[model samples]
Target: MMKSILFFLIFSVSAALSAQTLTLTEQQINQHLTTQLGRDFPINLGSWLKAGVRLADIQVALGRQEADKARVSGRAVVILEQGGVRRDWDISGDFSARPRFNSEEGALYLDEFELLGYRLNNQDASGQANFIMPLLLQSLAEYLAQNPVYRLDEQDPLQRQLKESVLGLSISPGQLTLQGLE
Candidate 1:
């Protein structure tokens, strides 16, 4: 009887330890981004810009670079009003991104964007896009670095959720895997 009890305990512990990983699929990730893009975020460009940035289209490629990085292609339009004259600056660009994990907040933010190409009003604005599209995207790498996109808990109104969370991340082309810490 004693031997049987000991074996059962050992088996249960090992199983629990190995089953601590979490994974998110590529489709799931894109769905989340799409939902977010649909929402209009009001941005004040101060003197340089005067309008809202509308994210028209966005596509994310995971595992395109390394296991922990991603590539994104997106399009946005900035309504720039200069001297009471408004112009539609349609921009299309692609960049590489990576996630910054925060254990304290139990969230991950997509950051480190490298602008590969940018076009404004049908003109290539790689060199001048910085000054033109100031309201829309001026170095999104810096902006997203401070924003958290994924949250592991806080689903309910006021509840303390998931005690043990993902400690490490392994991102692949089609999926993101979370590994337990310790």
Candidate 2:
């Protein structure tokens, strides 16, 4: 009886630990990005995820490279959730030029612009998308490092809400988008 009880206790603890663990894959990340946009302005997801790609680069890749005399502008909103908590970030701006259209380009190329808006929602649900928040938070962390001061405080309202997050990117393309941070 004692042995059985001990085994059950250990098993329970292990199970609890496993339940709290979250692993995010490239596919999941892409889904998170998609859900965040959810029929909003189209985003060249492939180019947006590339490493070393900044939001500005995304603007260019989206074919917004320069502010030509003739250009198109658009806006998009992204929502992210972690541990069941959700936060929203908005992106709005204009693209200057469209690059040479290529059959292989798909939906990933545009450049030139600006993002204006603020974070919304301090909490969300613990859905499958909840696990991807860590990646978003980490990306936001890197972004904050570059520009230490913004209109908001160091513990920006958003930062306080994300205090208990633990997540990482299991896979990523060559670029990452700081959407509005740029």
TM-score of 2: 0.23
Off by over 4 Å in 1: 1-19, 121-130, 134-136, 153-164
Off by over 4 Å in 2: 1-70, 103-182
Candidate of highest TM-score: 1
- lDDT by residue (tens digit), candidate 2, 107-142: 112222122322323344344324433344334333
TM-score of 1: 0.71
User: Whole-model lDDT, candidate 2?
Assistant: 0.30
- Cα deviation in Å at residue 10, candidate 2? 89
Cα lDDT tens digits, model 1, 1-182, are 99999999998798677656657676766676676574555565677556666778777777876667877778877666668866666777777788766767876678877676666655643544476554356534455567665666566422123324555678877787766633
* CA lDDT, candidate 2, residue 95: 31
